[model samples]
Target: MRREFLFLSILVPGPDHPKISLDVFLQPLIYELQMLWEHGTEAYDVSCQQNFNMRAVLMWTISDFPAYGMLSGWTTHGRLSCPYCQDNTDAFQLRNGRKSCWFDCHRRFLPSDHPYRRSRTLFTKSKKVFDAPPPEIDGYTLLEQLRDFGANRTPDCGGNGHEHVYGAGEVHNRHKKSIFWDLPY
Candidate 1:
C-alpha cells in the first residue's frame, strides 16, 4: 500500500469542475490499466535478482463527494443522490431552500430496538422508522445491470458513437454508465 502511494496521477486542472467530461481524460489511464491487467509489464526485482512480470488491479478510488459522482456516473445532487439506495432514497426537496436534503434518512438503518428509531421529536416530527436498509448490490450485478447502458459513451464528447442516455430505467441518478465499467474484470 505504501509503495503504491509513491506516485499519484492528477488528471485534470483546478478551479473548474469537469463533471461528465471526466471520462475523456480517463481514457488513456483506463487503456493502460486494461493492458496491465491483461498482459503485465516486466520489472526487475531487486531481492529476487531477476526480472518478473508485474501486474496491478485498481481496488478503489479516493476523492471528494463531487468528484465521486463524476467518476461513478451517479449524480450527487437531486432526490436520488445516493448510489446505494438508488430509487429508494428518502431524500426530499427543502421547502424554503429548494434543495434536496437527506435529513432523518438513516433511521431505517438503525436497530429496531434503538431509541433513535422511535424518537419522533429528535428527527422528523411524529415519524416512526420501520423500513429496512436497502439491499446490497454486488459489483458483478451492477456491471450486468449497466452492460447494455452504453457506458462511457457520450455522443457529444467523442464517445463510442452511442447516444448518451440519462436516468435510464432503475438507474435514476446516473448521467452515463461509468468509464470504470470498461474494465473486463
Candidate 2:
C-alpha cells in the first residue's frame, strides 16, 4: 500500500508565499514521523504467517541538497557547511569572525589520501605556496581511502545504545532553528 504524509494545506500559497519555506513545511512532517515511529504499528500481510516480533517501521526521505540540509539539520552555507569534510576542511577566519574557505578546483586533482585532504594546515603553513608536485596516484585508484562516517552512514553500530535522529535546541522564531549537530537522525 502507498502512503503519504500531509505536511501542510494545499490552499497555502506557493513558493512566493515568503513565509512558506522548505524547512517550515518539513519540520512538522519529520516531527510527526518521529512521533509515529515511537508509537505506531508495522505493516502485516494477511496471507503471510505472523512472527513473534512485529516488523520495524522505517522511513526514507528524498530531496535536493538544500532540502536535505534542512531535513538533516546541518549548515547549508558558509565555510563549515560541508557535512562530509567540514571537520577537516581548510578555511580561514575573516575580521568579521566568519570563515571563508579557499576553494581551488585544482585541489580535486590531489589524491584522496593526501595530507591536504584531512586539513589545509599542511599547505597553508608551507614556505612554498605556488610550488607543488604532481599527484602520484590518480583519483580512480584512491577510492579505497574514502570511508563514510556519521550516523547516516552507519545507522546501527549495535554497541552502546541508541538516540533520537531528529532533535533541536533553541529555535530562531518558527522558520529557523538550531539543528542537533550529532547525526542526521
Candidate 3:
C-alpha cells in the first residue's frame, strides 16, 4: 500500500551477499505464508467486537535488480538475463564493455504492422524483427522445468565444498527453484 507500511521480514548481515544461500533463509517464511494462505488465523475486530478469520496473500515483491535475481532464483547475468524471454532472449555481448547488452531486443513485441519492425535505422542496423515474442510460461510448467534442474530438492546451504550447477543446460537463466513456487497458489 505505502512505503511506511512495508516491513522488513528478514535482514542478512552483510560483508558478503547471501547469493544462492538465500533460499535457506526463505524456507521458514514460505512455510508461514503457506499456512496463512491455506488455514489463515483467527482475529478480533475492534469496532465490531467480533471474531473473524484473517488471511493474507503475497501479491509480489520489490527489490533491486541483483536482489531480484536472488529472490526469484533467476540469474540476472550473461546473454539470457531477462526471465520473461528465457531461452528466446535476443541479447548479445558488447564489443568494448565485455558485457551482455539487450539492445533492440524488444522489437518482436511490437505489432507485426508497426513501422519500427521494418525500419533498419531505428534499432539494429539492417535487421528486421519478424519473429514473434517469446511464449509465456506458466507456474506448473516452470516447476516441471525446475525439477529437471534438481532445485528445491535439498537444502541449499553454502560452504559444503560441493559445487551447485545452475541453469544446467535445460534452462538458460534459472539458477534454482524459487521458494515462492512452494505455495499451492
Candidate 4:
C-alpha cells in the first residue's frame, strides 16, 4: 500500500495535479510517500510521548491528511492553540481574515525550537509564491502558466505542448482540495 502511495505521490505534487501514470511520477511519488510516512511516524512518536490516547491518534492521523479539512464538519484551518491547536481544529474559517487563518498544529505546541519545523519538497526550481493574484511573468499569469505547463486535465504537458509535468498541487486537485496556502478550492 505504501509503495502504491509512494508511486502515486510522484505522479502528483501536493499543490498540483497528477500528470504521468506510475512511470514519470515514480521518483517524486516515492519521495512524497516516504516523506509522509516519515512525518506521520514521527508525529506518532510524539503523540506516544505525550500519552495521547487512541482518540488522539485518530485525530492526529486525520490531521495529517490534508484532505481531511474538506469534510463537512471540519472547516477551520488556523493554528488556534499550542502545538496541536491547528491540528485539532475540525472546523476552519477559510474566508476569514489572515488573523483568523488556521493551521494543523493548533492543538498544542512543540517547543519553539522543535527540529522538524519545516518539511521541504524536491522541486527547488519553482518555489510557491502567493499573497496577490498569480504574478504575470512575461505577460503570463500564474494560472496561465499552469495552463501553459499543461497543469490541467488534458495532461501530456498541457497547452504548452511540452511533455506535461505537474507539481503536487496539480495532481492533488484531481482527487480533493488540499488545505494548504492559497488553494482556490
Candidate 5:
C-alpha cells in the first residue's frame, strides 16, 4: 500500500532533451534481474561480463518473498504464497470458506524443552507447567545468549524456563536455515 517515488534530477535544464521517467529506464533492468533470479541457469550468458552463477545468484536481495514478487511482476497471496515453506504453511480456512488466515508463530522454532513451546488451552491457562527447563548450553541459558548477542534486554523469565520475548501469535516470516541454535559451538 506504500508508494515509492524515484527522482532523476537533471543537472542541466533544457527542453531539447525531454525528461525521462525513472521506471522507463529501470523496468528493463528489473525485468532482466527477475529473469536471472527465477531462471538464472537458462537466462545467464557467459559473454555478458557479469557473474550470474549459482553463488552470485544466491547473493542477491534479502527482502521478504512478497516484496520480491512485487518487483518481479508476480502476485503473492493465498495458500501457496510462502516462498520458503510454500504448501507446508500453517494457514487455515476462514468461516466464509473463501479465504484463509496465516498464523505462523514462534512455537514452530522453539526448542522442545522451552516452556513457551506449547499449545495454549483453557485448562492450562490458570497454571502452566513444564516437564523440563530450557537447556543451558556451555553454561549460558538462551536468555543469556540473547543478551550477549545484543537483544537490548533479557526477556522476562518465569521459573520453568518460560521467557516472554516474542509473542506467541507473532508471525516470523523471515527465512531461517537452522532453527536449533544451541550456541557457543
Candidate 6:
C-alpha cells in the first residue's frame, strides 16, 4: 500500500513541507505584482517585475510533487500534465471554468498544487466538467488559445499583463471567447 501511494505522489504536485503550506508559495508571486505596481515605472524594477515572483501561483501542480519525494509522470522540465492528454494541468481552476495551466503559463509559470489545498473551496466550486461530446465548458482547452497568444510564455505568448482583454487584439489575438472570457464588444 505504501509503495502504491508513493508511486502516485511522483505523478502529482502538492506541498510537502508541513510548515510550508501549499499557499505559502503564493506570497512571492502575489507580492511581485504589488512591487511591480509600486516600482514598475523605474527601469530597474521593470526587469524584476518581469521575473514575476508571484508566478508560482500559476506554475504549481500536484502531479509534479510528492509528499516528500517524486514518483513519476514528470516532464523534462519537472512538470506533470494530464496523464490521458499529456496537457499541462494547473493546481487551480478558475471559478468561471478555466484551467490554471492556461492561465499561469500566460502569467509565465505553472500553478503549484498547493493552492488547491488552500483554496479548496474555490477550487471545488469551480470544478471542471467534461463530457463525451464535450461539455459547454472545456475548462481544460482554454490553454490552446493561451499558448497561441502567449506562446505559453507565462502570462501567455502576448504577455501584456491583465490588460489582455479578450478580442482586444481582434486584428491580432482574436482568440475565441468562452464563458471564461466575457469581453465588451
- TM-score of each candidate? 0.81, 0.38, 0.81, 0.17, 0.32, 0.20
Cα lDDT, all candidates: 0.77, 0.39, 0.77, 0.31, 0.37, 0.31
Off by over 4 Å in 4: 1-66, 78-83, 86-98, 101-108, 111-185
Q: Residue-wise lDDT of candidate 3 within 40-61, one digit each (tens)?
A: 9998888899999998777888
Q: State the lDDT of candidate 5 residue by residue for 97-153, as single tens digits.
A: 668665532244456665555556632344343433323335244344344333221
Index of the highest-TM-score prediction = 3
When superposed on Cα atoms, how far off is each prediction in RMSD? 3.3, 13.2, 3.0, 19.1, 20.7, 20.1
Error of 4 at 182 (Å): 33
lDDT of 6: 0.31
| Residue 47, model 4: Cα distance from true site in angstroms | 35
lDDT tens digits, residues 105-153, model 2?
A: 2354466666554555655443223324343544333222221112221
Error of 5 at 150 (Å): 45
Candidate 3 least-lDDT 10 residues? 153-162
lDDT of 1 by residue, 1-185 (tens): 36887665766888876667788788888899999999999988888899999997787888888999888877788888888888888888889989888999888888889999988899998998989999888988777666655455442446434355545534566667777887877
Candidate 2 Cα outliers beyond 4 Å, as residue runs? 1-12, 17-23, 49-60, 91-185
Runs in model 1 deviating more than 4 A are 1-7, 147-171
Can you give the lDDT of residue 31 in candidate 3? 89
Which pairs of residues collide in candidate 2?
165-185, 166-185
**Backbone clashes per model, in order?**
0, 2, 0, 53, 0, 37
The full ranking of all candidates by TM-score, starting with the best, is 3, 1, 2, 5, 6, 4
Those runs of model 3 whose alpha carbons end farther than 4 Å from true positions after fitting are: 1-9, 45-49, 96-98, 153-162, 166-171
Candidate 3: the clashing residue pairs are none
For model 5, give the 10-residue run with minimal summed lDDT: 174-183
